[model samples]
Target: MPYVITRLCTNDGACVEVCPVACIHTRPGAPQFYIDPDVCIDCEQCEIVCPVDAIFKDVDVPAEHAEAIDINASFFRQNKAVVGPVAFETAWQMVQRAHAYAASVGIAVTAAVVDEAGVPIAVGRMDGAAPRTAELAVSKAYTAAAFHLATADLAAQARQPWLRSLVVAHRGRLLPAAGGLVIFDGITIIGAVGVAGGSATDHDVLCCQAAFSVLETGGH
Candidate 1:
């Protein structure tokens, strides 16, 4: 049996905090907290606190959300990937990690943290975060980390006369400059963090730092 958090959940986190066994991994900083079905007790407490009415039994899981069942399963299986051990971290934690650095630099920023597959896992906006800025941050981050190539590195490598033509063709689509970082567990790329409204270079550094913080701080 599986328990799923549906689209109706507003990510308020009340349900996440209430679980007795802590089967849920909804860290305070995650974008959307989810329950590991294998760990759930089929308890309805999560369903009880959800303000947006998003929780549901896996048996009654919506057709659109059916994929979540598999996602939950994949989350629990212990495995060693090229990077290292696979672990799940919350999106909120990712943003907070990046925000700590951005704060020091006096940059008000927002972030959209996502999985390697380009799915949004968490989104956060600091004071005055622009919509376009948030979007660009996510886009650039995804482009950089998904291909496992840094933006600047890519641009420099592309500068060869032969590759320049290819670079020109791709243009802005291949933002290898900075401002993005991979979210990973050991060797596995679990997700990514992107920040905007600051220097691209600084944002990039913070993005990575924040993601790493989640792993270190354990999503505080």
Candidate 2:
């Protein structure tokens, strides 16, 4: 069985840095980190390094932390896939790099980094960007993260009846605009980035692409 991170997890990131496969993840405000059953390699590194002793093999979880197995498992069940919630430092770097890229190209934009579940990890609005750009950026990131497809591809299908209905069902939180791209860590999806308020959708996409270089070069 895969290892599980219980409520005792402190999100201190000791285990995250130790895991060979990078399957441990938690957001900034999350109560604890979780291990992805789909991606974990069964290495006990997390359990070994976890300062709080929160990591446990599924079958070995103590009775006090037994519910943690379901909590950890159910988080992935709610998403199409949940390899990561993305480390906060990495998300921050992505947003900063995205905004820097947009500025370099003389464009004003809002950039957002969201986890696999489409929850915000980091966000930034360049100077002079429109206020509403923040919402669009987040929606675009959510579209890519929630569906595992870039907004460019999804926008083309937004005209179809089914796509239109899907957008509506989400109460318009899904943006089929061309500025979102999913991010990966060694073939495992970590999160997504979205950019908005650039000169054109293509400009937004270019900025989004540039931000990915941060991860490529640093593996952060």
Candidate 3:
């Protein structure tokens, strides 16, 4: 289970600093930090460093702050896949990085990240991007997480008759598109990232690739 950041979090950011996987995050001007259940390694590093003693394991959370458990998990409800511990803050940063990469290449796009269970961890769209692009990005992410393969590769494989039926069986949840790539923690498939809204499929692919590269490089 994941650790919960309670009401006592003072926005100190110490947990964020100590997290080895960079999973803890506080939104801009937010009152407290939130631990991303998907990305957390469950190392208890955050719990040890919290000066306010606000962090607690899922089962140990105080009743008054009990709602925080759902609050933390609900952050990744959209899309669906079996994913490991991933920090919401890190996932959001990955989207931001992907968006910036698209902009750098003169493209406008939407980016999404999902955990292994295909649950959306974070999503972002550039100004003027089409509304449908967001949905496509998320669908592609879910496909990658479900298949443990990049959506581009899955798209190619799905061309076979048997694979095509498998794709159809998903009832539109599986989008075998080029812009989705699986994320890994060493050899373990942890999640995926998807990109859409570019003029061509290659543009989307480029954005997703760049985003994964950011994760590989420690989001530098």
Candidate 4:
């Protein structure tokens, strides 16, 4: 079976570096290294050096992380599929007209840009964030992008006991505050940005401002 890097893979590159057959691709620049299953010999050595314990036998991937499996499989498509896009900008450049548009603001927040399919195109976690803050920020951005709605809007909708119940029923962690913005470019949901390390409203506004700035300046 072709060994797949599930969500457990943390981009450590240990597997890529250790492969004796050199089947795993280890080019100078690539998003989290990948193993070319077609070239791999199923050696268990890769399982040894991984620091994050991310390696998994192909059949062991859980249902919740199935998308990772699909991502790996699709990389072999005859026509290269678009992975995603991300560009960072100065706070003002990203959120243009911020001084005029928003009165109350919060700490400078990092932003993530995602594609239509809810895959990250780019991510930026501002310096000094808590250890897991990056992951939280990305998750919020993805949540905003997938529903094509602002985080605040979702929060508002969830305020209804029934709606909140339904959201919880689906096992969604929809926070009711701020910190995420669904990006739109000329009626197309091009991406989303989410901010953490601040109040819900603060984070939401920061991300929204960034989204607007990106729209004005042709994206970042």
Candidate 5:
């Protein structure tokens, strides 16, 4: 039987790096990763490396995540390519759409997009926004991608020593603030988006979540 990846996956890309056959991948719009049934060697390298313990043999998948078996197989049989940045066009367009959403809501915000590795792709700020808004935007995106969770959700764990060290190790670049989020396209991870403009008590998270709709629509 083949291996499977379930929703519990953090999309941390740990299993992807360890797969010998390179069969582990996330299809476009897939909320979590999937193991290609045909190419998986059943060598269990991924299972050993999975930090979330989300990978399992088709037969061994626990009852809670059992749906992954068919989800993984059907993904390989359906789509021809995994969703990546190329599908989202250039970074400029992405930023524009993010701000467009912000504009519609009468907010002056800055937006940033980062790859799965937490590298910045684009950062755009609207007029009347503080210059540092771009910094917050980028840091938020980085934090989200690195932790594989929305920054707001990470807030409760932000005070943990391990998480604090993680931030320090990343050159003090991560911000476990409200405006960052992981962007998922099905089981595959497209990347992350961050927006900042509103105050801590106001629309920061609202604007950040709105960016998801912008991203899902291909930023058009």
Candidate 6:
């Protein structure tokens, strides 16, 4: 889960400097900083550097500021990709569209889609994809959905001691590799797309990017 910036934020911007992904944002006149959940890798660097001790993990948010969890998430929901709620059918359509794009480019790949809860909604492997491609795709999709960040971004975070400990704590649930992207409806992450069986990480990222583009255009 992502961390929450509480009211105690002193506007020091210390957390912002330590964040490798630069997920923290603030304006000159703003009272406090905002951490974009979609971009945070949950590396806890901000938590370690906050002079005011204002940052808290989503699940550990104080009772008085319990609303901050939703508050942080709602900030992203302002511009939704779909007018209505995302559903299983919509997730499936996204995977199908990604598969089609991969095929068109002559890249046989496996793709997986997972909902906001990191539950698998749809998965597919194009003909001639590696046998293990489906499993890798699913793991990548789950990681993106659970962390609310692209797997490529996570690849860097995975090198951190805290992040590596998290991987051990989760027992390998988090796969920090390329080819996974968070699917945003506007700024709110609705799901994630993951692709595998490409010639390299860059190729896998390309296929996932195509899928994200479809989501960005509202599946057009």
Instruction: For candidate 2, report its TM-score.
Output: 0.62
TM-score of each: 0.50, 0.62, 0.60, 0.46, 0.58, 0.74
Candidate 1 stretches with Cα past 4 Å from truth are 1-89, 158-174
Task: Order candidates by lDDT, high to low.
Answer: 2, 3, 6, 5, 1, 4
For model 2, residues 22-92, the per-residue Cα lDDT tens digits are 57776668798888786664657778878878888998999998999989877666654435577888888
Q: Please provide, for model 5 over 1-220, each residue's C-alpha lDDT reduced to its tens digit, 9 standing for 90 to 100.
A: 6788988998888999866446787856668888888556465778988887988898888999888888898877786556675234545666776677677777788988888777888778899788989898899988777656778876776786656766777788978778887776675456788888875524767666666665566563
Clashes of each: 10, 0, 15, 5, 8, 1
The reply for model 6, stretches above 4 Å from the true place, is: 1-8, 20-30, 34-42, 52-85
Q: What is the lDDT of residue 30 in candidate 2?
A: 76
Error of 6 at 123 (Å): 0.5
Most TM-score-accurate candidate: 6
Q: Top lDDT: which candidate number?
A: 2
Taken over the whole model, the C-alpha lDDT of each candidate is: 0.62, 0.82, 0.80, 0.56, 0.75, 0.78
Candidate 2 colliding pairs: none
Question: Candidate 5: which stretches are off by over 4 Å?
Answer: 1-82, 86-94, 218-220
**Which of candidates 3 and 5 is the stronger one according to TM-score?**
3
Ranking by TM-score: 6, 2, 3, 5, 1, 4
TM-score of 3: 0.60
Lowest lDDT sum, 10 consecutive residues, model 1, at: 79-88
Ten contiguous residues with the weakest lDDT in model 6? 77-86
lDDT of 4 by residue, 85-195 (tens): 344453234433332233235343445555554566655555544556566556667667655566666665556554465447436644444666766554445566666
Residue-wise C-alpha lDDT for candidate 3, range 98-197, written one tens digit per residue: 8888888888889999988889989998997899999999999988887667788767556655456656776778887799988887655778898999
